[model samples]
Target: MIILAATPIGNLGDASRRLVEALETARVVAAEDTRVAQRLMQALGVENRPRLIALHDHNEREKSADLVELAREDDLLVLSDAGMPTVSDPGFHLVSAAIEAGVTVTAIPGPSAVLTALAVSGLPTDRFTFEGFLPRKAGERASALGSLADERRTMVFFESPNRLADSLRAMGHAFGGSRLVVVCRELTKLHEEVRRGTPEALAAWADDGVRGEIVVVVAGAVPRTVDLDTAVQEVLLLTATESLKDASASVAAATGLSRRTLYEAALRARTR
Candidate 1:
């Protein structure tokens, strides 16, 4: 059996009773970081001496099979440095391997920085998408934010403190300066803060440079300042670089326009 456990993101007191019992009795555990696991065990006052193995992004693929074999004989516990494993953390490969081997896969749900930040974001929560982490490069990050300019569902993202300000400015460029945003810093921790403002305001805040784990929650998109003609022009602009079909689909997505209509318009523009 493979048990995916959720460790405390902050406030060790949030550790569940089941989590403690499981850690107390488990003979073997795979952790994102062996040292962090030991520290956690010490903090939780668990006396069990479980064999700890490293299972991070670097070795997850090569080590997943061996871990699965161990789970076949004994209950193998999987955990990350924080939150649930595989939510922008390591665990998917192991879970997939366990499933393929007919090993029972279960989870002990607990503290999640994403959900925690979203709940306090003061934004719509009924529909939201968790975009784990954005690309680091300026061009790529800008392109990523540009693609979401029309995302109507509330969007959540994990970002490092260093990149927070630049990301906010890039988001402002893509989604407009006045778009609503919430930056949750050191969530559930002593320095916990939830700053609410426009992307421009937050970008200015980031300019000051801050430290802590960060989660960004942005309000859902509003209607675009586009009409049928404007949407067709956007399709045409993209078609200069992207295939006509691809351009039509992209523009339609961004403008909530009809793909077929955009395609036909682009086709007619070519003839004229």
Candidate 2:
């Protein structure tokens, strides 16, 4: 069986009893960083000293098969540097390989930076989406955000401190200056901070420099309130150069109106 374990994001006390037990008895452990795993064991006062194997982004694909085979004989515990493995961390490939090989896979759930940030974001949490990380380059990031400009679910993202300001600035441009944003840093740690403001204001504040692990949560876009008459007009205008079906879909997506409704309305207007 392959076991994916969750490590503390920052506060050591958050480590779960199941995770501690697994670490104590596991014969072999694959960790994102063996040294970090060793440090974690030491911090937790776990003296069993399980054999640690290095498994990180650089080598995950190459090592997944061998690790899965190893698990056939003994339980393999997978660990990332922080939080859950394979969540913007190493281990996804291994999990996939295990599933493909029909190897049983289970998890020891615990702290998660994504959920931690989202819970305290003060934004609506009824429905949300986790967008792991934004593109690093300005143009790529802008294009990426542009695609999600109309996303209705609250969005969660992981970011590096050095790029936080620039990403926030790009978000302000793509999502507009008035969009609400929450920046959570060093969650569960002694110096944890949660800052909330518009993307523009946060960008200005982050310009002076910020540190530690960061998670940014942004509020979703408000739905447009265009009437059916206005919406059908848009569909009709686009139909002059495209298929009615294509135009209906395009206008419906932009206005959050029903595609069929727009199509039928436009069809009726055309007949008249």
Candidate 3:
């Protein structure tokens, strides 16, 4: 059996009783950071220390097969430095291997910075997407942001403290300066802070520098209505140069309008 356990993002007190039990009872424990796991066990006053092995990003692939084999005979506990395993963590590979091998998999749910940040972001949480981290290079980051410029669901991203300013600047350029965003820093820790403002304002503030773990939530693009007559004329123009299907897709992508609506408009334009 493979048990994917949740570790505290910051506060050790957030560790659940089930998580503590799993940590103490597991025959084998795979952790992102063995040292951190040791410290956590010691703090929790756990007596029996399971055989611990490092299972970070670099070693996950090489070690997953061995771990899954071990899980076949005994309970294996998988944990990350923080939050749930397999979520922006190195546990996905191991989980996949275990499932393919028909091993029983379970989880000990606990605190998560992603949920914590989203709940307090003051942004619409009815629908959202978690973008784990952005590309480090400036050009790659901007290109990534450009693709999401019209995303209507709130977007979440995890970022390193050193790159927060650069990421915010890129967001401002892609999503517009007036777009709303919230930066949650050192979440669930002693110095937890939430800064909310336009991307431009946040970028300016971050220029002075910030620190600690960061989670950013940005508002999605607001949908705008285009004139029906204008949309029909545009679709007609596009169809002259492309197929009806291609024309409708192009119009929808360009105007942020529904593909169905654009196709209907195109049909009406063709008839007229």
Candidate 4:
């Protein structure tokens, strides 16, 4: 069996009993950072030191097959430097390989920056999407933000401290300056803070600089009168080059308008 264990994101007390047992008994442990894993084991008083292997982003693909092979013979524990494996972490490839090799795969669910931020974000969490991180380059980041301009569900994103300002600025341009947003910084730590405001407001605050691991949450675009008309026009434009269904989907994504409404509007426009 292949176990993907969830380690504490910050506080060591967050580690579960099952996680402790897994760390103590597993024959092999694949960690993103061997030293960090060792520190965690020391804190938890788990004396058994399993053979640790580094499985970070650069070496994940190359080392997946080897780890999967070991799982076939003995229990192998996969962990990231923090949080659950395969969540913007290093365990995805290994988990995929283990599954394909007919090995049983399970997780010791625990602390998650995504969920932790979402819970305290004060944004609607009923429907939300996790966009792991934005691109490092300005153009690529702006393009990525633009692609999500009309996303209706609350959006969650992770970003480095240095890029927070630039990211907020791009979000303001793409999603509108007044878009509701919350920046969760250093969560579960002493200086943990949640700043709530419009994207523009947050951008200004971030201009002075911010630090620590950050998770950003932005409310979805609200439909407006002009936006409805624009949606009608977009649907007509796409319908001119594609099928009605495809056109409706595209317009709905671009305008935050209901697909059924856009499709009905398209039919009426076509008849006229």
In order of listing, the candidates' clash counts read 0, 0, 0, 0
In candidate 3, the residue pairs with backbone N, CA or C atoms under 3 Å apart (3 or more residues apart, or in different chains) clash, namely none
Best by lDDT: 2
**Cα shift from native, residue 68, model 4 (Å):** 0.6
Candidate 4 pairs with clashing backbones: none
Rate residue 190 of model 1 by lDDT.
98
Pairs in steric clash, model 1: none
Q: Please identify model 3 stretches exceeding 4 Å from their true place.
A: 229-258, 267-272
lDDT of 3 by residue, 228-270 (tens): 6787677788777788888777667557888888898789768
Model 1, span 126-194: residue lDDT tens: 999999899999999999988888888899999999999999998899899889999999988999999
lDDT of 4 by residue, 117-236 (tens): 999988888999999999999999999998888787899999898889889989989988889899999988879899999877888899998988899998986754456667788888
Return the number of clashes found in candidate 1: 0
* Global Cα lDDT for candidate 2: 0.94
lDDT of 1: 0.92
Off by over 4 Å in 1: 225-272
Q: Per-residue CA lDDT of candidate 2, range 1-272, in tens?
A: 99999999999999999999999999999999999999999999898888899999899999999999999999999999999999999999999999999999999999999899989999999999999999998899999999788777899999999999999989889888999999999999999999999998999999999999999999998878899999899889998899999999877767789999999999999899
**Candidate models: Cα lDDT each:** 0.92, 0.94, 0.89, 0.89
Q: What TM-scores do the predictions have? A: 0.87, 0.92, 0.90, 0.92
